[model samples]
Target: MEGIEQNPVMYDLMSEMAFQHSPVDVKAWIDLYSRRRYGRFVQPMQDAWNILYHTIYNCTDGAYDKNRDVIVSFPDVDPNSISTLQTVLNDVHEQYGKRYLRRAILEEPNDSYDKPHLWYSTSEVIHALKLFLESGNQLSDSSTYRYDLIDLTRQALAKYANELFLDAIEAYKLDDLHAVAHLSEKFLGLVEDLDMLLGCHDGFLLGPWIESAKELAQDEDQERQFEWNARTQITMWFDNTELEASLLRDYGNKYWSGLLRDYYGPRAAIYFKYLTESLEEGKGFDLKAWRREWIKLTNSWQSSRNVFPVKSTGNALNVSQWLFEKYLQDLGSHDH
Candidate 1:
């Protein structure tokens, strides 16, 4: 929350030197470095500063040996606060490092070049710091100095969301119709879940269910009549084509993989059973039809496998578009 303006001399020198490069003073270096690296972004100065600080003041990196004398020459800035600089760098480093791992499932193909270039939510970074503190990232730390890292990470993450959201929106804007359709379906899934999460009676209406027989036989009530009417239409549709169950089974598997991997193993097995059942009947939707369609679909899926990376440490830098290609390859193999 603190801005560079809090310190007039340091701020002025850094601001001026940022526009021009003269190694005469540390003031010039900080100015140019900050502006060149981060000033283009609206509010990323703090992040830039932490990165610069780490690069310059890192005790273990020999920065202290080369730049320490020049850095101390700056007026109104505490050379002694090198420790504070270290703290900020430590915080960023530890947090980003952990994010590299936690997001591993999303990373594939390769991550070697991507570790240092990641953008982290304030909360995620803070969570990493929390984990570090709890583990005494250094064995020398005091045990009683306890604090919640999640809260800290949350604060940072919240601020970072605007940037992330903007990026996602821009990406979506450039996406093709297939991506838009997928996004729409995902939105619909979330909206449908609201009824259940909010405990609304209408939630039950989202899924398939048979009406009570007595109510069906006796109801002349308008509300009941409307419900029965909707149900009848759906039932007729199902009986006429026998497509709903098959579609549900297929969609359920896709949704399980995308959004509910934790509960998917069992659910996928159940869905597989239903799929097998659907094929057992001498219906049009038999194994022969499945095999024919599967060949084409898996081919398409395989073609997309190169979009992601096969190796990663979950860092954004490591994440690659080539992983999509790999996915397509895997789909082809799986289909076979």
Candidate 2:
């Protein structure tokens, strides 16, 4: 507690803000032991946000039914309450996620998210770096910190994108490609904004994924690696689960990279089409193989993407550059 009090000016402000906005001052305890300004806070906030969102999404309160011996069921919760809580958590998650995404995108020197007014926080972080520079900290040694911040933010975004993208894919299976599309749009937008964070020189790995997604949507190639079923399932299950190792054994890491290179773009577009079809016809493909292939691709892609500086972004991109510009073009054409 004394150390928290002794912390710098920004920490004080953040703590106060957290307390004010938080539901039960739960955020304060979190802030006390946390480095509120660093990337570490991102995951915790995300976890909290998800718990709140999912709880509200699934819960209901009712007067104790003495006859039934139960207080409530999901059916008992007022829909409005669930919706309201969901909205609150979603708004917070969106704002927080976007704040970090903006910082990574703009390549802000430091990783501070100080301003709440600007809708984006990169400039604030850049301002902090300028202040740090004016204060005359050694540049070479400290420069690594900024770069490290970039990597940290990127990884955080990657973690988020990986999760959401996977969720979107599973949702698509229930004829919910619209949900998948929405998630993919968020993920692609984050990637577009945070492209620099990838540290890939050609950015080829991203390009193909985007392209294949778009192509699949156009029906230009039913066999495209990035077809919705393939891409989405991989992100949801394969990359996120133990299946990654098994997929790698058969296709090798290169196959996954190739899938990422081909599908990221087109999948976004296909997701939209599937969504529309679901709404109009209530019909959608099973996407089983698509899911399996996606698992294979994302498993490899995640490995390479997470390698940090020890891995060369150029080499990683080279493994699947053929689909680079196509993915970018599809992404460029779509709205986030």
Candidate 3:
């Protein structure tokens, strides 16, 4: 808390991002926490809660809008009322480190939601709070409902992915080709990490199926039909519903360096090359044909996962280091 207070830049940036038009009802939220009875923990908890809620609200552009009203409408309770909000916040802060608030703010468009201005949904936040409360705010209590390992891993991966994505965007803007290729490989490697952790390795390993599809088809159209069928089957195997598949696709296929430089880069280069060639020959570029070819290329790329041998040694730090080394090696080889 002292460290955070000393560094006002983060809070300032959060305020600028969050309070563009909608000013937070700070007094109302403070009043809500003040009314709660948590003995010695009351005031400190209120202060922490205010900082967290205000930061979240501001940084996320009011995505947690309902929480604001909910807090304002909360009824006063006796000093002995059973509540673990304070405990949960403390645990989250400790586990995630002092800069968790800032990291969370910067890591928008979280893995759960890929759309702009929808990094984290209200329900997801509420669900996390509810789990903490239900578990008596004990991080060690895994007997009941909990999100210790998997959720934390997911959050860590999401944060890393978002950081890489931001770097990639900046590199792309600058048209730094080497940085683009290096960062893209690292991003894809991270995605591979996530896929392995989530047990999505089997479904996305499309090399065998693609080879079979190729062998079974006599014509290009038949090959495409086979590929589509295989893709549909793979989708169904991984996801229970169309909505689930869509979410997976949207969140999984983030616009990272590897994807942009390797997949789109080649296609775009080929397209423009053909355009130039056609112009030189006094024939117009066949937009329809190019579009068809692009679709086929994209589909083929989408069908396969970025497969890499990433060992899970049960140590998070060790695993992260391994991934980093792999990323560096991949970049050195320029093996997009």
At residue 7, candidate 2 shows an lDDT of 19
| Runs off by more than 4 Å, candidate 2 | 1-143, 162-180, 200-246, 249-276, 289-336
| lDDT (C-alpha, whole model) for all candidates | 0.27, 0.34, 0.38
For candidate 3, lDDT tens digit of each residue in 25-100? 5556444642332222334334433443543344644453221111011111111121211111222333222333
Q: Is candidate 2 or candidate 3 better by TM-score?
A: 3
lDDT of 1 by residue, 30-131 (tens): 545433432232223334344333432333532211211110111111111111100111222243233322222233343221111123333333333333
- Higher-scoring candidate on lDDT, 2 or 3: 3
Q: Which of the numbered candidates is closest to the native, going by highest lDDT?
A: 3
Off by over 4 Å in 3: 1-148, 200-294, 297-336
Give per-residue lDDT, candidate 1, residue 166: 25
State model 3's lDDT.
0.38
List, residue by residue over 79-112, the lDDT tens digit for candidate 2.
Answer: 1121110111122224433422212123224322
Pairs of residues at least 3 apart in sequence or in different chains that clash in candidate 3: 18-58, 184-257, 184-258
For residue 103, model 3's alpha carbon misses the true position, in angstroms, by 11
Worst 10 residues of 3 by lDDT: 67-76
Better of 1 and 3 by TM-score: 3
